[model samples]
Target: MRGIQLSFNKTQKLRLDKALEQLEYFSSKLNSNAIVTVSDTIPVNHEDGVLKGHGTMELEGEVVATLCGVVERVNKLVYVRPFRARYKPEIGDIIVGRVIEVAPKRWRLEINFSQDAVLMLSSMNLPDGIQRRRTAVDELNMRTIFEEYDVICAEVRGFQHDGCLHLQARSQKYGKLERGQLLTISPYLVKRQKQHFHHIDQYGIDLILGCNGFIWVGEHVEVKDDMIEDQTNKSEQQNNKLSGLASHQNQEHNYTPLELRQYICRAANAVRVLSTLGFMITVDKIMDAVEMSTSKNLNIHEMLGAEFYVLVAEREAERRSSSSKKR
Candidate 1:
């Protein structure tokens, strides 16, 4: 017989036998009887009544009596839950991603979960400076740098507030990767690491494993002796031509070697600064930082010429003004 019972509050007390009698009378209309017996305090709500077990009769809140019913078979296996959230990228996580789009300044990478990651122009190392305008030849050679469907190991810089991850590859260990078979895997399974570059010694290949699920593999090989001999012969011939041109320039301008070295050093430093920051490094910004270290009043026009430095200086001034306004 299965029946429902209500337990009295703490201030109320009634004999169990009397309670059972009242329950039977109340449940008779439903064709059930309250079976009275002892039971352990199996936790039941105030609506629950006596089942079969021996337990205490003390009631602090509400007491309820439950009616006994026929026993049914029970299943005992534990259940597992499923994950229900999108993937969140962290620094140094390995991921398998695909190139979705490419622009002159950046590449859009689909990392397989949320929004695509951006690989900025400053994060790459081209033969010329970042500001060097591309020529027709450069456009033809663009694929020599990176092409569509090419996979690379990239580091996650950070994520936008809307959850887009930014990527960078300015180190020698990264950029212009070649000769590697790509691998794909689930982003969640890839473990985050401190460094993105790693050599798979067991496989005899260098792997740039990304936390976004991208992987690049390349084999170690040495240049052949015959190829080195031919390259050396060609380089010597070019060196002779360059020497003749240098002598002509020296006689015409009397340019000091020290001045030339200074210009090269400044340009290299500017490139390094921009690469490290993974953003635009205008000429004025570079000149400002350079001027602070030198006693001489350096002419920006003389250093970088008129056209190039003018554009860079304008950008730098704008950046400074915007920053100052924010502060």
Candidate 2:
């Protein structure tokens, strides 16, 4: 869906436009006058010495927007949240990023931010789950932990004094993602929440809703319960490894089932449709779209059809309309 141009027939185009209009109407009712465009001066108490946030800059002694977006002010801090743009990181946000450059003492990731984010080796635990100070040998073996192009999950550790965004992955759940599909959507669609990691029990899959645009749909991985292994368990595990090393390796390489793979693609397609329709993507709505396809017995390939797109747009319009009335 990223580069594909979808063509809609006349009837489909009109229907889609109407549905989008309704959706826009409902959204505009919430903040119709707050929208501003490039170089537009933000309405603020100029005497208060307002601190400008992202998407804004102080030009000629006036706080003017640098992009087209909605204006927000918190106390004396004012910023513009752009409609369609790269992710703006906040501290403690769970994110999925791809390793771009394994730099010295740090692994730089492309988190869809204005600049790439860095995850320092000193900031993360070793593979053995130790928190000791990183040694020279550890720096030499950084690639062994995370090579270029590896998709990983981590949390925001906030910006540094030098203005670099740092990330941390001290938890077992945060590590290299394997045997999964990565999908990118609008970052604003994903609001920060308490839980971004979701396990779909029915499909035996894991869905990570990154605060950034990247999403991961993969086979469910049972999180390792213990970070520090006791001597007894280590001994048992070593004995077990000695008993059947090949078998253990085979188990580790177990392939995903065909049925599960199909479901993953189906779920990914649901996300694609939602993104294309400009709808706010959430786990519940994604599951609903998947369930709709399942109930209708539609094939995975058919989920991207023009008809399905129209249906999703219509469904969202009707849903928003109903919720508005209930309020």
Top TM-score model: 2
Residue-level lDDT tens digits of model 1 in 1-327: 011123434322233334334434433533322232233122334343333232223345533223233111123211111111236777655454566777666677777665788876666545322324546676556566666776655667787676568887644445544444554433433345565455533334454545554444455323223343345555674675587468756855753355444543444343333223222333334445445324345452333332223333344445555655676
TM agreement with the true structure for every prediction: 0.37, 0.83
Highest lDDT: give the candidate number: 2
Residue 194 alpha-carbon offset, candidate 2, angstroms: 2.2
> lDDT value for candidate 2?
0.87
Query: What's the TM for model 2?
Result: 0.83
Which residues of candidate 1, in runs, are more than 4 Å off? 1-86, 92-96, 127-142, 160-164, 201-203, 221-327
Q: Candidate 1: TM-score?
A: 0.37
RMSD of each: 29.0, 3.6
Candidate 2's clash total is 0
Error of 1 at 266 (Å): 48
